[model samples]
Target: MEVRASPREYDGTFVTTQFGAENVKRAARDEYRKLIDKHDSEDVLVLTGAPTSTDAFRDTLDEVLPGATTPYVTSPVVHATDVLNQTDDRVVLSDALRRELRHRFLADYEWETEYLRQASEQPSFIEDLDRVMDTISWQNISPEETPELREITAALDAFHNWLAEHDHIERGQLIPEALDVLTGDDYNDIVDINAVLAVEFEEFFPLDRAYLDALTGDCDLVCIAEDDASVRRTWVETGAITDYVSFSESRRASGVQPSTRPAATAAYFAEETVVDDPNTGSVSVLAADSGDNQLATIANEIEELIEQEGWGYDDIAVATKQSGSTVTETIESFERSGIPTESATITGFGDDPAIRELLAVARHLAADDDNEVPDHGLELDTDRLARVGEMDQLEDAIRWWATDSGVKERIAERETSLDARSQFGNVRRAFRMAAFLDDTAFLDATWESFEEMLERAHEYASQQNQTSATDLDGGVRVDHLQAIKNTSFKTVFLINLTDSEYPGDPFLTRLFPTERVASMPDYPGVTDLSNTDVDQTFPTDSTASSRPFVQYHAEHARRCLAIGAEAATERLYCCLYEYEDTALEERAQASRFLTAAYADLPWVTDAADPKITSEQAAEEFLLSRVDNALADVRRANSQDVTISLDEVEAELGEIQELLDKSGVRGEELRKALRARVEFANGEVRR
Candidate 1:
C-alpha cells in the first residue's frame, strides 16, 4: 500500500484510505496499520466516507496505534470542514446529535418534513438532503422537477438557519465551505499535503475527489484500490470502484484456496471434466428439505470439520445472502443446534438487553417518579437502581444505576461467550452515549432526546457502522455475504443461495427510477463506468418488467457471489434448500448462479461419499439400523423373518441410551423403535 514513488520531494504524511461500510473501514484500518508497521512506517491520518463519527474511529486508532503519533482520523467532510472551521472555530454537531435535534425542532416549531415524502417514498428526508448536499446536485435539476427540487433546497436552508441559531454547523456544509476555502487565496492543508496517497479508495464522489485534489494540487495523489481479490493498482478517479477483476482461469482457487467463480447463468451443464476426491470436499453444493434441516446440516458439518480435521470454530463462517430477519433466524438456528456464532451483522439496539435495561432507568429518571427499573420480564440482578448520592450528573447517575442493578458487573464478568462479547459491545456504546450527553449542548437535554439519540446510534450501529469479522475474536462467524469482503476463512458456508435471494431485487428509490441511474449526468456514480453495463450478467425476474433494474442488480449479485466464493481459503459450501417456510413463494430452488457455475465449480455431491458434511454420518447409521430392524419386526409373523428378541432388546437399549443423551432423540425414530417392541408383545398394526 506504499505510495507509488511520489514525484514530490517532501515526505509529509501517511494518509491511508479504505472504502466500504464502517466495519470494513475499521477492519481495513487495522490491516493497513499492521502492513504499515511491517514496512516500518506509520500513518498520520485516516480518511473514511463515514460522516457519522470520528470518536469511534479515534477509539479504533487509540486501540491500535496507541501512544504513537496517532493519526488524525475522521470522515472526509470533517477533515475539510474542520480545516475551514479553523478560521472561526465553530462547533460541529455530529450527524447523530444533529438528527435528534432536527426532530426536536420539528416538533417544537410544528414543522413537517412532509415535502421529503413528496419527493421520496421512504420519507427518509435527512438522507435525501444529505445526498443532494454532498454532491451539490440540487442546483443541477431538470426544469420539470424544479418545483420539487425547490422544496428540498428550501428545506436545506431552513435546517442551516436552525443550526446557525444554535451556533452549530453540520457536515452538510463541510464540502461546499471547504471547496470555497480551497478555491480561495489559500488553505493550510493545501501546503501541508506535500503528498496524498489514498489506499483502496472505495467511495470517493466527484465532490470528495475535487476537494482532495484541490487540497493536494500536484502532490502525490495516488489512490490504490484494494477492495477486489483481483484488483491491482487499477486507477479510478471517481473513487467508487466497481470493476473488480474477474476470475482468471489460472488464478482460480482449487482445494487449497477457495473462490466462487460466478457462472454465466443459473443453468447446470454437463462437463467432461472429472472432479477429484479431495477437490470435491473443497467446493460443493449442499441441498436440504427445509431451513431446520439446512442449519442442522451446517452445524453437523462444522462439527465434522472441528472434530475430524482439527479446524477451530473461528476458521468457519456462515455468510448468508439475506439480511434482517433471515440473518436473525440463522443465528437462532445455530444457537438451537448448539453452535456458537458471532454475528458480524448488527441485530440492533432494540434487541439488546443491557441497553434496554439502562434506558428503562433513564426513562424512570426523566419521569422523576421511581428509582426502580422494570426489568420487562428480563432476569436482572437487582430490582432497585440505587442512587449513589454523590453526583446528580447523568453519566454518573447511569454508572451508579448500572452498578446497583448489577448490569455493569454482569457485563464485566462475561469473557468467552458470543452473547457476552456482543452485550459488552452494546454496554460500551451506552457508556459512550452517556459521555456524549455530558457535553455542553446536551446539558439541558431531556430523557426523550437521550433515548432518541440512542435509538439512532444503535440503529446505525446495526446497519453498517460496526465491527469487522476479526473483531469477533472467536466463534463461527455469521454475517451477510457483502460484510465478509476483504476477509478470508478456512471453511465458508454461503447459505441461502436461492433464486429469491442470490440475485436480489434492486433497491430503486420512490424518488427516482433505475433507468441508467448509475449513468445519468450528475448521477453521483456517473464516473464509475464499471457499473455501466451488464452484458455478461444474466438478468433475474426479480424486476422482470424492468430489464435495466434487473440487470443492475444481476451484475451486483454476480460480483457479490464472487466475493463470497473468494472468502474461503480451503472449503466453500454453496448451499441451497428445497423448501423454506420463510421463502418468498414457500418453495425454494437453487440459485441459478450456482448451476451456471456448476461446470466450472468443484462439486462432489454424494451424500455418503465422505466428502459431503451436510448430513451426519452417525445419525444416518442409526436411522438405517432402525429402518432395517423395523422391516424385520413387521414381518415377524412370516416364516422368512427371524425375530431375534433378546438381541433386538440389547440393540434397542443401546440406541435408547444414546437417544436419552440427545434430549430423547427424534420422536419419529422413538415411535419406530416402540412399534418394533410392540410386535414382540403380539400387537400388530400397519
Candidate 2:
C-alpha cells in the first residue's frame, strides 16, 4: 500500500479530532485495533474500494500499529493477482500483458470461427473485439435472443482457455478463481484468514459482494460505508455482516466549524442550495481562455495557497476528469512553473527514450527491415545482436540482447528525469510484454506489429484507470478525479470542467446494443436505474434506448465532482477552460454540471480585476500610481492651477526609490505589469 499517495496534509492549525475524514479514520483505526486484538494479523483481511482509500487505510494502520506488522490490506482491483496467486507456476498478467495476449489470440483466431470471420471484415474489428472483452459480463445474454451472443461466448471461452493453457490468467478472473481454490477442503493450505473488512461498500459491485459473502460463516465480517441501505440489503439480511455502525455526522478539520467547507461544497452536487457566508472561503470557480491558461492560473493560485495561507505543497492536489494527454500536459505545465508534482500516470511510457530504446533493439533483432533501428544514438551493436541471432525464449532473448547492449543500465541511469518512477515502471512493463511472446511471435514479429502491441497494451492498460500516485514526498499531486476519491487534501482543484470533455458521451459497445445492456438491473456501473435525484432513468421510447447509459455516465461525473468536493477539507476550485488551444481554435461551453454548480457557488475567480499580493504586483501598482500622478501634475500646470506638493513630495520620493529598484519604467512595466498573460517561460509566451 502506498501510504503517502495523498499525503494527509491539512493546511490549517486545527485539532485532528475536528477533521471529518480524520474522525472517520479514527473510527476505522479503532475498528482495526479491535480486529487485530481478537484475531492474529494473518487471520484478518482489510479491503478498500480504491487505491487511494487503500493508501489512506495503510496510513491509519501505521498510526495504530506504529511499526508493528499490519494485516493484509488491498484494493482488489489492483492487488487481485497478488491475492489470487495460489502457486509459482502460473503467470499472472496485468491489463497490459492481458491485452497483448488477447490480440495474439485474436490474430491467429481460426478463420473458421463465425464471429472472428464476420468481425474481420470491419476496419475496427480488433478495437470492436477489445471493447466486447472489456464489458463487465454481469449480464447473461442468451443466444436464443441473438446467435451472435453464442459465437461471442465461444470466442471468450477459447480465449480464457488459451490463457490457462499458457499458465496465465487475466486480472478479472483472479477473484473468482481464488474463491474456487479457497472454498475447497484444502483451502487452509492456500489462504488462512478468519476475518474480513471491506470499506467504501457503496462502490463494491455485485461480484465483490459475492466474494465478501463467500468469506463468511467461520470468519467475522464487517463493512464501512457512507451509506448503509445497500450493505444491509445485500449482506445484513444474508447474515454475512453481523453488525453495522454509522458515523452519522462526519466532521472535518476541527478548527472553527469543522466539516463546514466539505459539507457545503457537497450540497451543490446533491442539488441542495448552500446559504453563503463570504468568510467561509471554501468553494470557488475559475474559467480561463484555453487549456494552458487554465493550468497557469491554477499554478498561480497554488502558489498563493502556499505563500499567503501557509499551505504546504503537500496540502494541495489538482485532479482532472480527463487523463492521459491531459495528465501529461499537466506534468509539463507544472514543471515549467517550477512546481513539483507527484503522479503515477505512466501512459507516456511507451514513447519514453528508454522504453523506445528497448523496443528498437527488440525490433532490430527480430524485424527484417533495417532502416534506422535505434541504437542509443551510438555506433552499431548490430554485430553482437545479429550474432546472438535467435534464442529459445522471447523474453530471455530480449534480456540477453539488452544485457549485452546495456540499454537497461542506461535507463537505470536516467535518474534526473522527473516522474522517473513511472519511467522505470514502464521499462519493467515494456519488458513484461516480451515474456508474452514466444519464439514464433518474436522471430516473425514485424516492426509494425511490435509497435502495435505496445500501443494496444497502453490503450487497454489505461482503461483500468490506475493513476496510483506515489508517496507523500512534499510535492503537490496531479491525478485523475477517481484516484483522489477517498484521499483528503487541504485544497482540491477539480479541473477540465467543460462540456466537450466533462460528463463525456458514452461509447456504444461492439457486440451488444445499448438497449440490451442498459435494461439489465445487474449492470454494475451505476446505482438505482430509477434513482430520481440524479435523474437516472430508463426511457420508454426505443429511439431513446441509450438514455440509461448516458444518464449513468452523467451521474458518475457528478459523483466524481462530489468526491472532489468532499475530499477538500478547506478549499475547492472547480476549474474549466473556454478553448483547448487546438489548430482550429474552437470555443467550448461550460458543462451542465459546472453551470448547475455555479448557480450555488458564489465565489468566482475575477478575470477582470484580481487582488495583487506579490512583489511584482506591488511594482506594477506603484508604476501605475506614479504615471497617473505625473499626468495630474502636467494637467494642473496647463490649467495654471497651483497643486500642493508638500505632502505629495515625500510620497513621490518613496515611489521613486522603489521604481529605481524595479528598473526603468518601461522595462519594469513589461516585466511586472503585463496583463492577459496566463503563462510565460522566459521570453516564450503562449
Candidate 3:
C-alpha cells in the first residue's frame, strides 16, 4: 500500500489522514481545495457522518476554495437515497406509509394496546425491522413459540413482499439497493468520481461499508478520522481502502495542543477558566429543585450572560437528551423570560392542547352507545352536542365547535399556537381516516379502532419539528446533543443532566432481544464502536462509553455549563399519585458526569429566584385589574344590577400602584392597563 503524507501546509493533494478535533477543519479544507483544483469542483462528493459535519465541511470549503462552486456534500443515507430515487423502476414509501403499515401490523395483535402503541412509536422500529429482514434468518424461528416475534417477522415479510409486488421501497432499503445499483453498468456514470472523502465517522455499517467498497473501487478514498487505529484498520479491511497517513504530528505542529485533563472533562466544562483564566470564560454546574427549576436556573444564567458578558442570544446553545415535558417547560420558561430561543429538536405535537381536545371530542363522538362527555372543565360546544349525527360531518362539526367554543382562541393565546395549528391539521387527517373507514367493518367493530387511528395520528405529528417563533437572523439555538455537533457557541447550557437523561438510557431495539441482537455476526457490537456509530445494536452498559460522545458535544462551545437536579421531587409526587393508598418511595440521582466534573469546582446549588421583569409585572398587574373588573361585571349581571364606578376605580388604582412599584410607569403602563380592562369588559359581555 502506498501512503502519501502531507506536512502542516497544504500540498494540493488528498490523503487519508488521522487528525484531532482542532485540525479536522483545516485538513478538510486542504483536501477539498486539492479535489477542486484537480477535478471540477462539481465532480467532488463529500460524505460526512452528520448533517452538522456536512455544513461545517461546506463552510470550510468556501473559505479554502473561494470563488469555486460548492461541491455536493451529504450524509451517506441521504446520498444513497438520492441515487436510488433517480430510477423509476421502484417507488419509495413515505414515512406516513411506513407508519400506516406499523399501525395495521399492531392492529392484528391481541396484546396490550399500549405496549403495541409504544413499540410502533420507537424511533428505530422501522429501521430495526428492515435490518432484521436484510440480515436475520426468519425460517429458524417458530410462530407458536414466539408469537410477538412471529407477528413482527410476518408483518415485515408482508411489507417487503408488498413493496416488491408494487415496485415500492422504503427509506431503509435505499442504501443497500443503491450499493447494488452502483455495481451495475447503469450507475457507472454516477459512481465515477475524482475522490470520496469520509469525515468524522468512527464506524461503518454493512450497508455503509458496501457503499464505500463500491466508491473505493471507482475513485480515490480519503477518510479523515480520529486517532483510532482499530477503526482505521476496520475500514481498510472491510472497506478495502489501502493508504494510511498520520496527521497527528502535523496537527500538533499547527499549534493544536491536546489538553492535559481528560477529554471528557475538558469537553464538559469547555471553558478557558479550566486553564486558570477566569477572566477569559465562564463555566458552572447548577443543582435545582426540579426540571422546571433547572430551566428557571438556565433562563437566569442566560439573562446574566447577556447583561454581564455582552453575549447575544444567538451565541448560546442548550443541549438535552430528550424532548420531554421538561423541554416543554423550558421553552415556556424562556418565553416567560421574554428570551427568544429556537428549538432544533422534534417536539411531540400530541402535547398541544388543541390536538388533545380534538382527539377527546372524536373519542366522545365515536362512543355512540356510551353517550357521555368526559368533563375537561373547558366549556366546549362539542360537549353540548348529543352526537356527531354523521360520520362525514365530524370534521366540520369539530372545527365549528372548536371555533365557536373559543378553543382556537385559547390556543392562540399560547406560545405553542403554531404547533397547535399543525396538530389540528393532524386531527383533520385522523377524521379523514375515519371517514374513509366508515363503510368498512373496522369502524363498526369498536370505537377503540378510532382511538388507535388517533394515536397513530399523534405519532405522525410527534415525528415532525415543532414551531418556535425565532428571528431569522439570530436567536438562542436550542437543540439536542446530536443536532448541535460541529457547531460552536460562546456559551452552552446542557440541561436535564440526570443519570438517566444526560447520556440517556442505552437504547435496545424492541424488535429483538438485546442479547440476541448483540450476538449477531453483522450487528455492530458495543465494545469497539463510538456512541454515534453504534448503529442499531445495543450499546455497552458503561457510562464511560456513552458519556464521551455527549462530552464531545458539550465541548463544542467556548463556555459550556450544565444543570441537573440532585433528586427528582416531581417523580416522588408522581409516585405518590400512582400508589394513592399504598406506601411508596422514590429517589433520583444526578448524572455521575456532573458530580465528576464539578467535584473540585465551586457548585451553584440555589434555585434561581424567579425574576419578575417589568414587562411581566405590568402584565400581571393589568391582568389582576381585568380579572377584578370581569368579576364585578359578572356579579352585577347576575344580580340584575350595576356596580358602582368607585369600586372599579379602586381596583385600577391598586393596579397602577403595583405597576409603579415595579418601575412600569407613565403612558405605557396606563395604555396597557386601559386596553386590558376594555378587552376584559368586552369578553365578559360576549
Candidate 4:
C-alpha cells in the first residue's frame, strides 16, 4: 500500500494535492497554522479570488489561530482597492453612471435616442453597456476614430472630467493605477506583509498575476490547488505562475472519516427505500412539472424530512444554479410551508419595492412638462406638479409632494415588512440624497444629467445595502451553489438540474466574450472563462470542469438530494370546460448526469393524462371550487373576519347535495352536515 503524506511547507510555499474540498481546506489550515507558528508573527495576508473563499479562509484562521486577532483577509480586488488604499481622489463610476453615460452617448451620436430611451428601462440592456465598455477597454484602442465609439468615449470623458473637478477618481481606473503603484518603488511602503496565502484560486488576470509575482519575490506564496490540471496548465502557459513544487497526496486528518458516496442511481427511484438506508446516507433526485411545482415539491419534501426523519431545518440546505426570482419563489414557498428559510446570497436592490417606487417617482418627475399649478397654500395639488417643467417649480412640487404624499411613511411600511430592512433603509437614504442633489448639484441639470444623478444615488444605496447571507440566523439555508461551497449539511437539495440550467452557458457580454476575454494577454484576473467548456455530463475521472466541481461538492454532503422539472404546463379553459394539455407544455430534458446515472431506471410518469374525460374534467373543476371555498372560510375564521353568508350558503348547498346523492345517511350524514353548518356559522360570525 502506498502511504500518502501530509502537506507541509517546503522552501516557503505549500501546495496541497487533495482530491476532496474538505481535505483541501484541512490541509490549508494545517499548513497555515505551521507558517504562523514558525514565523512567530501575525503579519499574514490571505487572498483569494472570491469573497466566498475569503470567508472560508477566515473561518479556518479563527479556529486555528484562536485569540489571535483575525489576520488581514480579503479578495484581490478588495485588498487592492480598499485595504491597500491604492486608489486616490478619483472615485469609481457606479454601474448606473456607466449606463447613463452610454445612453447619452447613443442618443447624441448613434442616432439611437429612441432605442436608448427604451433600453434604459431594461436592467439587462444597462448591463450590456458595461460589457461594451469592457470590450473597448480590453482592445486598448481609442474610440476617437470610430464615430459611435467617439460618442461613447466623449460621454465617458465628460463623466471623468466631472469627477476630476469634484476631486474624485473613476473606479475603472483603480486596477491599472493600483498595478502601477504596486510595481513602483513605493509598493513596499503600502503593503507590508510577511507571507501571502492564496486559496482555492484557479485563474489569475494579468494584473493579479503581476501582483502575485511581485509578492512572491519578498514573501512566501502558498496556494491551494484543487482545480483541474488543464486549468493549472493554462495558468502556467499564461505565465501566471513560475515553476512550483506540489504535494499530491491524500492526507486525512485524525478522526475525520470520508463521507460515504452513495450509488449514483439511488436518486432516480420513486421510493425513499431505494435511495436511503437506515444506517448509511443516500443520494436522491426529485422530479416535478415546472419551476413552481419544483419548489412546492421541495418544500413538501423538506417539511416531511423535518417531521418524519426528525431532522432540524438547519441540517438541510437548498441550493440553486441561478439566483433571482427563483430564490424569491423558493423562500416564499418554504415560508408558506412554515419552514423558516434564509438566503445565503445578496439579492440585488433592483427588485426592492421601495427602490422601484422611487424610480417611478423620479421618472415621472423627469418626464414632467413646464405647466405648473397655481399656488394654493399648502394644499397645492401635487399631481398637477407632474406637468410642471421648470426646474424651480418642479423642485417646489417635489418638496410639497414629499411632505404631503407621506413617501417616508410608505417607505417605513415597506422597511417593516422586509427581512433585511437595512436594504430598504439604504434605498430610502438614496431617494433623499437624490432629492437633495436635485436642489443642489443638479439644480439646472439636463434630463440626462438628472437621470445620471439618480443612477448614482441608486448605485450608492445598492452598495451600502448589499446584505451577506452569512449574517442570517438559523433556518434552512437557501443559497446559490457558489455560496454553499466549503460548507457541509446533513442533507442538501440541489434543484434546477436540467441541461439548460446546470452548468449554465457562460455570460456572453457584448464586447468581450468570456472565452476571448479570459484568454486576452492583459486580462485583469482569472474568471470561469476556461471552465465554460467543462462537460455537462456525469462525473468521471476525466471530468475537470465546473459542472463536476459542483457535483462533487454537492455529493460531499451526508445525503445529496436533487430535483428537476420534466415539463412546464399551462392550463386552458373553454367556456365551462378546463383541461391541461401536455402538447402545449414545454419540456426540459433531464441533465446528462441524471440520464447517465439512471439509464435503466424507469421514468416517473405523470399521474395526470393529457386527455381528460368529461366526468374527470367536471370532477376537477368541482374539487378546485370546493377546495378554494373551504380555504377562504378557514382563513376568515382564523383571522376573526366575517364572510358573506349568502356566498357560504351557495357553496355549502352544493356540497350537501353531493353528499346526499352519494347516500351518506344516518349519523355520518348528520355529523357531516353539522360540521359544514358550524363552519359556515363560524365564518359569518367572525
- Which candidate number maximizes TM-score? 2
**Candidates' C-alpha lDDT:** 0.53, 0.57, 0.49, 0.48
Stretches of model 4 off by over 4 angstroms after superposition: 1-14, 40-42, 83-87, 101-126, 132-173, 229-280, 303-317, 323-348, 367-418, 428-479, 489-491, 503-583, 598-686
TM-score of 1: 0.64
Q: Model 4 compared with the native: what TM-score?
A: 0.60
**Model 2 residue 103 CA deviation in Å:** 0.5
Question: How much does candidate 2 score in TM-score?
Answer: 0.71
Q: Write the number of the candidate with greater TM-score, choosing between 2 and 3.
A: 2
lDDT of candidate 2 at residue 346, scale 0 to 100 = 34
Tell how far residue 130 is off in model 1, in angstroms.
9.5
Better of 1 and 2 by lDDT: 2
lDDT of 2 by residue, 23-93 (tens): 45665676677788888876778877555667767776667664567657776554445546544357666
**Candidate with more favorable, higher lDDT: 2 or 4:** 2
Model 4 error, position 657 (Å): 14
Q: For candidate 4, lDDT tens digit of each residue in 386-500?
A: 4433445334544445556665566666443334454444454444444444543423444434545565544533222121233554577776555555555666766766654
Superpose all Cα atoms of candidate 4 onto the true structure and report the RMSD in Å to 1 decimal.
Answer: 12.5
TM-score of each: 0.64, 0.71, 0.59, 0.60
| Model 2, CA-based lDDT | 0.57
Q: Which scores greater on TM-score, model 1 or model 3?
A: 1
